[model samples]
Target: MQDEDRRRYHDLRPDWAESYIRLERAASLIRTYEVQFVPGLLQTPDYARAVLSVVHDDPGEVERRVGLRIRRQALLDAPGGPRLWAVVDEAALRRMIGGRELGRAQLDHLVALAERPNVKVQVAPFHFDGHAAAGGPFTILRFPDRDAPDVVVLEQLSGALYLDKPSDVEQYRRVMDRLCTQVEPLDRTAAILRAIRAEL
Candidate 1:
């Protein structure tokens, strides 16, 4: 295997760098539930910069991280790689992270990406009367290998937690299932996204 084939498991600071590398390597089907900003894989460059600058002050470092984020997303387009099924809260769509124009571009990006057969975008509306994913944002990574099992990633204020045990992973799986069911259907999500963009 080449260098990129290897999975590194640690990185600097409060970031879950190594876990993200594992995500890039092992995830054959990536399911994410985000209640905040857009998932890194789906974020526009400006949106990514806005999210990154919230923690880092240096423009140089922020750009470097943005490049890394954009690179990670390349996996979604790689041949025979993972297919992303992301359920984003409606709040994330309406947040206007970078600004109104950037927000509109982000919505346009999401709508365009959802057109891909492998990419599934579902919107979790506020009217669900509370749901299983109320805990917070997380990613459940499923690998192609049968023995690998699913890995659940939870980002915190300082660092991140990577849960690999069957019980923990199963719990997150259940939350993901409930989220998928509760969110608007794909077509409805597309319409909602367009509507949100218009408002922006």
Candidate 2:
């Protein structure tokens, strides 16, 4: 895409999302726990469009948002990209956005991405009791620079919340640690994804 498109992407984001994006691009490690739909960083284009369509009626706006999401995904494969670790709840897989075909493709994409050394995808099986992050989806961004502080992002319906205080960051960090323990491991993650895809 042209540099202008990149600029437009930045311009389109809500102020809160724009703030998180700034930290996202700078973080050395991005840890996410999603309970609903697929995490934005890992979403497929069609899936992303299906998501945006629910709230946005304008096709042009949906396409613009999808373009931005897909473009953001490139950083996962870019040189010296941040290491991504995501724990996705089984509910997200079962939700099946954009119909079966699109959902299947999205699961396949997740399984493929897990193969990368820097990317980790896990599933919190349906059997799990009392989900650690029952509040909703959130992400923690960590930078390599010790001088930089870690931040937590809490996404809401119309805007986003950023947490930068040490105590706030630490609380989410503990939640993430406990959350990871509840999900399947790397090997099982791939198998779980494929099994879900088969059902789709």
Best by TM-score: 2
Clashing pairs in 2: none
After superposition, candidate 1 runs with Cα above 4 Å error = 1-15
lDDT of 2 by residue, 31-102 (tens): 999988888889989999999998899999899999998988888988888999999999999896789999
TM-score each candidate. 0.91, 0.95
lDDT of 2 at 72: 85
Cα error of candidate 2 at position 26, Å:
0.3
lDDT of each: 0.84, 0.88
lDDT for model 2 comes to 0.88
RMSD of each: 2.8, 1.5
RMSD of 1: 2.8
76-130: candidate 1 lDDT, tens digit per residue: 8888979999999989989977889999999999999999988999998877888
